[model samples]
Target: MPRVVKPKDVRRAEVLDRALALFLERGYENVSLNDLLAVSGTSKGAFYHYFPSKEALVVALAQRSAGEAFEVLRPVFDQPGKNALERLNAGLAASYQVKLGMGVPEPIAAMRSLLMPENQALFRKIVTIWEDLFRPVLTEVITQGVREGVFDTFDPEGVGDMIQGFAASIQDYLVRMFDAADAKSRRKTIDDCVKRLKLYGIATDRILGLPDGATVVLERKQVEAMMTLFMPSRPAGSLP
Candidate 1:
């Protein structure tokens, strides 16, 4: 019997899936193209055929991950049964659940990597891609809230931008706190973020579905290990 050959798209997807797992396990910079090919069980030619460089691979992975997140939340915005705020809250809860289910540190590792000055260009490109992809969805949700009188903001587009900026700031703050091994500061920052969102007309109850004064808790040792893996230069200390 002749050996079966995979379709081009299937082969490309398999390579990407394997590469993503490798990148998530070992930080992107720590994994070379040869390492990716080795883990993916793909020839150098096939790897190059799909991704010309490691940077391209990273971009592809980011796009796919971001796209999946969007898909997960998109329906909440489109579905008609729920009120605007409820939909928004459901979408956020679902997103958080997805992140927790992955049990991977890709988000933290990728964010830390992008914060480095050397990755500034790639970071900017990714920011642009995410802004383009998410802005419309967020804007639509905000617009729905405004129409339903749930949000007082007159300018949905501007409010959407502010919301995105706020979320980004919180994420950056968490990354910094994780680096510093300051879990107390991390929890405080999360509370502060929730309070600020309330000021923006977001209901306190829908503040990412987090309980009062409580934030998503991760295993301290696991988080510390991930921080060390992604940011080795930071001084180690016990998590607060």
Candidate 2:
């Protein structure tokens, strides 16, 4: 007979959700294991059993984040008649939209933390994970575009790197300027950026007629609701 599953997965998932919240509100340096335990409502022993160290937990979180992102875009990429560039751009835009709603302070928050001397190695490992996820999809798109004579370039590997860089930049800029803590400014920034990105496209508009689906607009609403909840501003000149 098959063995029954334990509650460890459930507990670990709970811990991760709390950890992500704390990490979003407070950076990695500010949050301690004690903080994680308190926020997660789990014991130190349980936490340690699941995650031997805070770094280990963070590594798991990073991997999960990247994996989740890939899953969200896989559907778009698999759609018929969508060229590599179309898939690439759609993926980037949709992912950014979801992230904007989800209270991700920055797209590269985990990567940025790794930029420090102590975290550089960890950062590299995470980059490898992301690269593995993006490289094949990007390369295939480039190859297909070139075969169809829609694209001028033919270097799949270089094009893949460019795709990753472009996505990262969009995230960094959107999160910093549009998704800022302030509500009014955040809304304005998001409105402007969304308008511009929709026009210019994220990567290259090789494949024609890609649909936006519900990801961008729905996520934008979520952000608006979050801003309302946290900021709760009133009409101009209303307060003394």
Candidate 3:
């Protein structure tokens, strides 16, 4: 027979899931503990036991969501056979899928909110966690690509930052439009951005002349990593 689960565990998970949903649907300020209680069917005491306050709960929710996302993505980057660039591009694709699946809204909203003076230190801390995770792998890939004559010259760290900035902007746009049900258009924008990114700095010669599946393994690995790595944070801006 299967083992039975505890009620508190079930309640905690339910409360979190419901809270996450509400936070996503309504901006953080708009959603209340009472709202979560109504949706989760849990007592205030139970909610407090799991999450001390609304702000603390939201913070926990953000951290937990981001953590879950990372677990899903880390494997792609960790794959041994994949080359760096292939992983990078594939990561972008996987990221889009995760966003769609998780129903995440515009990330910039969260980023901006997290940047508020009150949250800035924590925001920076989380940003550092993120940078620590992606920077080494990304830098290694770019550095190796340069050494192997696979890429034209660019600073590895700078390139990494550029990629992150670019992806963040694209995600922000995707989420805002997602709320409008303009996913198709949002996807088109992403495709265009990818094409532009490839053209701007990536070696056209390497990609243009490569045989089919040359990049498949790495791309898949990247996509997997990105799926887990990227996710929504606190809502920063007011809703549109």
Candidate 4:
């Protein structure tokens, strides 16, 4: 057989997923280009064709994470027969359900790996992916809120930036939560995370001129579900 040619998208996704699985398990910095190529079964030139550099490859993974999150949020934001306030609240809950420590094993592993201190630069790149993918759509929703007289912002873009900045500032706490050494410390960090989320929601309401409880940026039960991921794994052969 003349060499079988996979569709470009299929081949690229195959290489990407396989290589990313390796990176997640091995840690990104521990895996070199040759290692990625070996695990992915692609030649150097072929890997270069799909990803210009190692950084680009990991950036794509970050984009995939953000893309998954937005996919969950976008429909809620765009739901028919829903006003901006309703849609915004729904989107916020939906995102809280999926992102954070949402129990999807791959993303949890990927996040843990990326948030490693050695991967700080890569984590920063991922943050940009999230911001780029999140901001414009939110600005549109903010515009909708303004048009509906549901919000009191003259500049939807500025308010949107403020919301994103507030959310980003809380990210350091998340890193600390992941870094917590013991179950008690992790539990405390989780509480701090929840309080920060509540504060951010309140800030959003104030910025948009809605009542303090108007925006549902997070919910108690949903966060309770997400926090289970941070619980230290039980020792082997211990209580279930």
Highest TM-score model number: 4
TM-score of model 1 (CA atoms): 0.64
TM-score of each: 0.64, 0.60, 0.54, 0.85
lDDT of 4 by residue, 1-240 (tens): 699999988998898789778776777778899898898888999999999999889888788768877887788889999888888777777665566646667666666666667676767776788878888888899899999999988888888777767766665765786666776776676677778888888988998999998987655454444445543363322211
Local error of candidate 1 at 80, Å? Answer: 1.0
RMSD (Cα, Å) of model 4: 3.3
Global fold similarity of model 4 (TM-score): 0.85
Instruction: Please give the ranking of all candidate structures by lDDT, highest first, separated by commas.
Output: 4, 1, 2, 3
How well does model 2 score by local distance difference test? 0.60
lDDT of 3 by residue, 128-232 (tens): 555556676667766766776665556777666665555444434333333433445534544554554444334433432333333322232332233223323
C-alpha RMSD of each candidate structure in angstroms: 6.7, 7.7, 9.8, 3.3
If the candidates were sorted by their TM-score against the true structure, best first, what order would they fall in?
4, 1, 2, 3
Clashing pairs in model 2, backbone N/Cα/C closer than 3 A: none
* Strongest candidate by lDDT: 4
lDDT of each: 0.61, 0.60, 0.54, 0.75
For model 2, the stretches where C-alpha displacement exceeds 4 angstroms are 1-6, 102-131, 175-240
Q: What TM-score number comes out for model 2? A: 0.60
